[model samples]
Target: MTDLWADYVDASPEQAEALPARGPFGDSPALADELLALVLAGGKRATSGPPDPDEPVTVGGHWVVSDGSDRERVILRTTEVRAGRLDSVDDRFAADEGEGDLSRGYWLQEHRTFVRRVLGLSATTDVDDVEMIFERFRVVWPPEHADALD
Candidate 1:
């Protein structure tokens, strides 16, 4: 899986150019929808679906599709995030331990765009370094929700 992930990430034309990236991800990172609910629900009730008013939704970690509803709930933990990656597909933790899974759809949507942008930037900028180019791509690309060019 690591190899596959590496292959996908390395294939980015941006990764091929080597550009430097600068900036902080910022507060209130993006959410993956249902996963946030499970963490806050707590216990067995911590499955996905419309969240309970008492629970605080967390967008990280492994999740469960509710008992009767076809929704997923995630388990939030402070140690499950890395950059934009989730620690557990079911646990939405903060990214400080190492590389968490960065395959969430929201992240992918923007990342794909960033890759394309980097290619264009590297092809035009004074910087020909692929890695550096990928870095710059992240800034130019829009958020995943901005996936639609509209």
Candidate 2:
């Protein structure tokens, strides 16, 4: 990870002073790899989850996305951030996620399951009441990877 960051800083001199957040998607190795592949293939552009108090995402902030083994794959620049109840997720945002059937119904069902397992919510808990942070981003590094998707 450090080497990847160094290389990025070296290539983009303007970002030499920037400190970006770094992490892989999902809670496990297999899931992280799956999501990373989706991002790389231009199938995913948005994600949502519980807010992180220590590393709140901001528009224009950079993030180094990694794979299952922690190999940095791309740098993503945040374009938008929205906070709302889980039930508030809409069709547009769901399609932007590029997952399942790219429908709001699929998103809701999948997220409800995710929340229950990952957030430790009981089956009876109302996932609609949970707060969620939705973030939209564009890949910024490795021009070829970003360009191919475009």
Candidate 3:
């Protein structure tokens, strides 16, 4: 992680100093690798999670992304952040997540299961009102391809 950050900072001297990394993604090794692949491929430009008020995401903040093994592989600059109930996730945001057919229904179903698992909620627990923080970012390190979608 330190080496990756050093390389990025050295290459982009004008950008702000690095912030601590937020994730390798997902709750397990396999899942983390899967999501990281999507981000690298430019199929994923957004993600969401339970709100972290103490460290709210800010636009222009650079983030280091790692693989399941905790080795940093990419840097992302946040472009947007939104907070709302899980029920408020929209179709566009779902597509930006780049998972499961790029549909809102798939997102909801998958996230509902994910949220329940990570939070230790019972399968029957209602999560519609859970607070969520949605974030959109762009790959800024190693540079993105010209054809990569924004």
Q: 1-150, model 1: which lDDT tens digit per residue?
A: 133223323644444433222111211223222222322322112111111234333332211222123232221111121122211222221111112243344433333344445345443333212221111010111122111222
Q: After superposition, how far is residue 82 of candidate 1 from its true place, in Å?
A: 11
Models ranked on TM-score: 2, 3, 1
Clashes of 2: 0
* Per-residue error (Å), model 1, residue 48: 28
lDDT of each: 0.25, 0.87, 0.83
- Candidate 2 TM-score, true structure as reference: 0.91
Over the stretch 2-48, how does candidate 2's per-residue lDDT look in tens digits? Answer: 56667777888988887899999888889889888888889899999
Error in Å for residue 105 of model 2? 0.6
Candidate 1 C-alpha error for residue 116, in Å: 0.5
Rank the candidate models, highest lDDT first: 2, 3, 1
